[model samples]
Every structure is written in structure tokens, then in C-alpha cells.
Target: MLKASSDAEALRSFLMGYQNTSLTYQTYLKELERLVLWCAHVQKISISDITSDDITAYQQFLMLPEPKALWCGNKRSKRLKSGEVNPDWRPFASELSPTSIKKTMSILDSFFNYLVQTQYLKGNPLSVNKRRKKRTQPQTIERWLEKTEINTVLEALSEMTEPQADAFSIIRAKYIIHTLFYTGLRLSELTNHRMGDFTLIEGAWYLKVIGKGEKPRNIVVVDEYLDALTEFRKAIDCPGLPAFNEKMPLIPMQDKLNPIKQRRIDQILKWTFEAGARRYETLANQEIEEGPKHLRRASKLRKASAHWLRHSYGTYLVKSGCPIEKVKTLMGHSDISTTMIYVHIATNDLLDSAQGLSLQEED
Candidate 1:
């Protein structure tokens, strides 16, 4: 059924379908490229020849990629430059976590299914189930900033200087942070959306976005977000509120003519996070009694990223009594199960509710 003799050729064909969406294309390319490399180099087998046992071995390999010197590279290492593959490039950055392994397996399953449907392969090896094991506890979401840490980051942003050279960048960073927190839009959604996507329906505003799987959804725009948008526009010398069908990028480049790339967005957030961490470190030194607490917050802020804001958004909403279904919609989660992780944030409230229960009879 397969026309492509090499796994590399098959991977190229499969990824071609996703070329229109850069984010998805990149993700698929990363996972599939690693798999092809592993099949050729480590397993000495073709992708079409992989079996259920081979998949099990692959899963174990992901847990701890063997011969780290040959399979792993530093996070900043480049895979390609000027259309040439770098010799230092490695498939694995570090050992994959259980969640990461699951995600990689899911992506591989989809890839194999696509191949099967297109007659490129016979069947998906990943679909063959092994003996069932006892179900383990669900992993809790941990990569989110607490409310106080978020406030510290906000304070750091507020203290940023608006020099003529960096005025637009500073304001844009502020808007990006607030939008991610309030709307929970994924990184790609934020970059792809245009100012025109913010529409007024009746009296309220909503930002329309094409989320994961090309699903369209409108996220409600709160007053604070609108205000941030206004500030961002003013910084860029556009209208205070976006005009109807305004074709400007939601987050523009320094030129104010092009949309900021995802890499730039990541860099901006990283800088902001580091700034917040530094600010906390300074506070820690100043406030002797609260030094330990401040130091801990500084450490967490140092580790925060753009996705952390998304998690923080969902968590804060669940904490604020927002219904799970509504949170799911706002988060663009296709499955309620994906949204259930935020429910863990309510453990304290759930415990508080139990305070009313008593073993002794009440009068």
C-alpha cells in the first residue's frame, strides 16, 4: 500500500497536509522526525515494519533516551541552519515525562492512522493494546503562577519604562500577558488573530479565533482586556478601540506592519518573567522577615512561561466559581476531561466545604 519506500519520504508527505498551519506543522515535524530518525538509526527497522512490541520499546526509550550524547541536545541547540542539518542536532532534549510520552504516543497514533487511511501503511502498531494495568492517579497541573506571583509580574510590567526606543514593545508585552491570562488563547491563536477579530455583539465584545483542530470559537473579552487592548493601540498610535474590520495584527512587530512571530512572543514573555523574578529577588533582600517567601516566589517566576499564563487563566477561573463547562469553552478544550485538571485548584474550597460536616449530632 505504501509508495514511499523511506520513512523520511512518508513523513514529508504526511506533514505536507499540515503546512498551512505553522504551529501544527512544526509539532508534527518534531515528533515524526524523531520517530524516523529512531527507526533508521537506533532500531534499524522501517516504520512500516514496527509492531506493538516495537512501540513498547520506543515508549521505554522515550523515558530515558539511550546514549544521551547521541540522542539529546541542549534546549537552545539548532536542528538546521541555512537549509543544512546540524551535526549537533539531536532528537531528544531530555528524558520525556509520563505526560510527554503519552502526548508523543498520541501524535504517533494519529500519524499512523493517517498513513493507514491513505494506504501508505497496513495498520497502526500503536493501536494494538497490551495487558491492562491498574489505573494510576491523574497528573495534577503544576505549571501555573499563583495569584500573588501573577500580581508580582503585573507590577513588574507596570514599572517598565516607556522610552521612545521600547515604548511599543513594553506596552505590547503588557497586553500579551493580560490577554493570555484573561482569554486563555494558545500561543498560535494569539499570533494568528487580527485586531479585526475583536467584534462587538450587542453590547459585549468577543475575540474570534481558530483554535486547535481548526475549530472556531469566540472568547469573551472582559473590560480589563479591552482596556489593555486600548493601551496597546495607543502605544502603537492606532485608534483607542479597534475599528470594525481593522486589518492590523493583534500583536504587531516593532514595525507595526507585521504580526509578531511565536518565537518573538516567547522571548518577550521570557524577558518579562525574568524581570518579575529579579523584582521579587530585590524585594526579598529588602524585606528581611518575608525573605524566604519572596525567594521562593522569585524561583517560580523564573520558571514561568507563556503557557503558564494559560494554565493560570483556567485555574483562576475555576477558583472564582466559573462553571466547568464555561471554563472548557473559554479554554478551547475539546474534551471536558482536559478541562478537569483545573478542578484540582478547588481542593481547598472542597476541603472548606467539608468543614461543615460533623461526626457529632448538631443541635
Candidate 2:
């Protein structure tokens, strides 16, 4: 429990206790600071002067940036020699993406709940039980690799040479990618997975994942990924660690001048780009030649971030004959609505179902 009279003090206390958790405490604290600063600016009052209305107004302002022409944050120049344009000047402010604003708002809501639970505040302004105006559903857009493009990436990875490439490391990275596609596990969950986490149920492989908010779920892994996993484990052959050398890291980076972390996983992705992965190059070229566009056009399919593999997996399964509920479970999504976004069923499939219904009616 926490007790603080003012917003700033309360924020300080809230952040103080969060240092130990693996969650992005620094990033989240910075966002909260931004909100507090904005609130102070608007009210022309000290941080301690903040009230429930201030929090409410701040949330509204976050969603709807000032309509009046305002300066954009500093923009980077493309060329090294080409110096920055008037660093002091701001470009026309663009509205924050709904997705971005929504994520921040979610943070605030959670913060407020924490404050209330800890007795720091009398009431929570963001409480959903309070009446509110209608809000639009969140935009559902995802970038995924096409089936052909996924195969191209796997093929590129498969053809890597030795000396420059270590069979054990490359295979582990490949298996991780395939497992993400087959299991749709979140990045954190994948990182936490041990060899022992996998189980063979009726000869099918399944991996357990601890998803968002600490909820546990199991994802199905196909035979292909299992075979890849087995090969990768055998190649590594590290001893003295339990559960497939659980004490030893599954995919130790060749560049391990330091400890293994998510950043290293990102570096693994950079290596993929070097290994004839064409996605990033295509995206960079397209971004320059083409104007602002949708995600599919803006980002290359193969060079997408690690999470995009999960998106590809979800989309493919839904596009196939898999039920939506089952896909949701495999993806470890708490909400059915989140799973709905990935389902892009073909018109032909829908049409076939309609025809089946018509046949039944005729009978």
C-alpha cells in the first residue's frame, strides 16, 4: 500500500518499488513523467495541485493532441553531412497514433488502480465503472510475412556457410523462429522456455507460456518444429545443465562480449538481415520511394521484428481451417477480440460455408 498527498509524490513512491521487476520500469516511469509535466503545464499549478479532473483532462489531451498547429519533435536528417534543419523549429504536430495513445492510457489506468489499492488516492478517475461516452474499437492492423516470404527466409538461413556461421547458433535461431511460427509464443515466454517446458502429448508437441499479466497458457508445436528443436539440442550438446542444459543458454550469441538478453535476440535479427534476408532492404527502399503507406507496404515481410512471426502464425492458422477460439489459446491472447484481428479468412472459404448452409436449407 502507498500513501502520498500529491501526484508527483505518489508517482515517486509507485516507481520506487518497481525497480526490481523485469518490466520496463524506466520507460513506464518516463511516460508517467510526461503526463505529469503536461498536467502541470495545463493547470499552471504545482504537481502537488493535481486533482482527478487533471488526470482526466490529461488522458483526453493524450488521445487528442492540441488541434492548433504545434511543433513536432526534432526530426533527423538523412545524410551524415547534411546537418539538421533548424533544431529549434518544430514541424506541424501530428496526432499521436491511436495505438500509441491507447497503450499510454492503459498505463495510466493501471497506475491509478495501483494508487487506489495502496490507499494513496481516494478514487480512480480512469475507473471503467464510471459512465463514459462511446469509444471506438481499437484499430486492428498487423504486419505478417507471406507464406512464400517465410519460406524464402528459412531457405536463406539454411544456406549459411561455416566459419562465418556456427551450425549450433544458426540452428537455434532458426528453431526459435519456427517455434514462434508454430507456437505463437510471446517474446518473454519464448525466452523463459526450457527444454523441459516441451511435452509430447499423444505424439504432438506443446509448450507452456506465461503470457501478459502472468497468465499461463499452452501452445501447440508442429512436428517440423519438434524435429528442428531436437536437431538443435543435439548440435549444442552442452553438459551439466538440467532440462536440455537449462542452466546453459539455449542460443548464446557469437558476439557475447556480454550476457544474453532481449537485445541479443535483436542482434540475432540483424544477423538475419546480413544473411541474405531481403525484408529490411526492401522496406528501406520502399519507404524512400513510396510516400507514407500501410504496414505491409512500409515494412518488409521477412525483416519484421520478432513479434511479427507470431502475427504470421496467427494469421496463417486462422486463414487455414483452425477455429478462432483455438487460435486465441495458441497465441496466449486473453481476449477473443485481440485474436479477431488476425483472422483474415478468404472470401472463397466464406462462400463455401454459405453454399453449405444453402444446401442444408434446400434439403
Best by TM-score: 1
Best by lDDT: 1
Q: In model 1, state the lDDT of residue 72.
A: 85
Candidate 2 lDDT by residue in tens digits, 108-162: 7778777878877666776642356477775355466666656656766887778
My TM-score estimates for the predictions, one after another, are 0.86, 0.65
Cα lDDT of model 1 by residue, 206-253, tens digit: 999888877888899999888988877887788899889888888888
RMSD of 2: 8.4
The regions of model 1 sitting more than 4 angstroms off are: 19-23, 61-82, 86-97, 117-120, 129-134, 161-165, 350-363
lDDT of candidate 1? Answer: 0.84
